[model samples]
Target: MTAGRAAMLLALSWNMKMEEEIKKILDNKPNLRYVVTEVGGKASEEFRGKIIKASMNAAINKNIIGKNAYESHALLHALSEAKAGVTINSSMSVSFAMKVAIVRSDHWIAVAMFGQSAFHPMTNHERGGFGIMHI
Candidate 1:
């Protein structure tokens, strides 16, 4: 295999292992809400946009963003980052918003959310071209 392919395989393996480890940890603590979504076979702007919109809507519908002007501004910034295809890792407990982590490989981009149960609905929405797993 080419070096690039080898590296991609390594990353995929590592991510799968990490996901399993995270699942085990979350399983131990059932009280904490955890939602994971994966999009297989490369990342696209459309998929990213959908995730951004869904996440933003979830935050807004949960009253996490609008309650405080500062929080709203922060979320807007996060949305911009998402739009730019930047990875997100925010974990503010008071906002009722979900933290997003994007893991990418040569063939896929996986988005994981950790927060309220409301975020769970955002998973498994990519219609086709991407394989989604929610756990």
Candidate 2:
């Protein structure tokens, strides 16, 4: 498989594992809620707005404020950076970046994935899904 496909598969696996872990944690604390949102396609204004709206609605339904909601821009940036082989430090793996982004966000509302190929301004891949959630 191509490197990009391989990376995407690995990311999917990692995300699945994370979902399991998050589930366990949440199970222990029913008072807390975890919202995992995904937006896959070229990052457009409309797509971003959709994610923002989804996140806002989720937060409001859960009685949360704007500050408590999280966006996945940092995660997307880290994935891009990792794919580009840009490392900030020795421990700056893609997984590390993802964890950091999630922690910083606290309540991630969006996790946008752009492009199937890792090419610059990745094009050709058909847009798939918008503001998907795994809550």
Candidate 3:
């Protein structure tokens, strides 16, 4: 892998470990708040956006920026929060999102992503998502 790719992987791994540590520390505390949504497709954006607004009571704007840095933003959001829940489209995105969430925060659980998951392995690495499901 190129140096840049290696660096990104290293950073991701580090973030995952840090999230775990943070969760362990916060588990002792009481009353933590969090939310989760599956972030994909055109309809998904609307649903998740509504959820965010309802949960936070604030309007959060999202722009289509040619898919430049999804993982980074997701990871940052995960790390900044105490607990998080994630909903994924299928087994492929589930796995990818789980990895992202794990790197962001330890207190995360992916809804599902085990059976009949077929993804374009090459593209998955860069986009951080799975392609399709084949049963």
The model with the greatest TM-score is 2
Please give the lDDT score at residue 15 for candidate 3.
Answer: 52
**Candidates ranked, most accurate by TM-score first:** 2, 1, 3
The number of clashing residue pairs in model 3 is 1
Q: How close is candidate 2 to the true structure, as a TM-score?
A: 0.35
Per-residue lDDT of 6 in model 1: 23
> TM-scores across all candidates?
0.30, 0.35, 0.22
Give candidate 2's whole-model lDDT: 0.33
Q: Write the per-residue lDDT of candidate 1 for residues 9-90, one digit (tens) a residue.
A: 2223335677566546544643332233332222345545655666556555644344566554555554454333322331
Give all candidates' CA lDDT scores. Answer: 0.37, 0.33, 0.28
Per-residue C-alpha lDDT of model 2 across residues 1-135, encoded as one tens digit per residue: 222332233234345676566546544654343334343322334434444455445444544333432333433443344323322222211121121111112332222232232224333322222122222
Name the weakest run of 10 consecutive residues (lDDT summed) in model 2. Answer: 93-102
Model 1 gets an lDDT of 0.37
Report residue 60 deviation for candidate 3 (angstroms).
Answer: 30
lDDT of 3 by residue, 1-135 (tens): 222222123223335476455445444434321122222322244534533333222112221111335533443343323112233443323223332212112222111111111244454432232111110
Q: On a 0 to 100 scale, what is the lDDT of residue 80 in model 1?
A: 55
Candidate 1, position 27, lDDT: 47
C-alpha root-mean-square deviation, each candidate: 15.1, 12.0, 14.1
Question: Which parts of model 3 have CA positions greater than 4 angstroms off?
Answer: 1-16, 33-118, 125-135
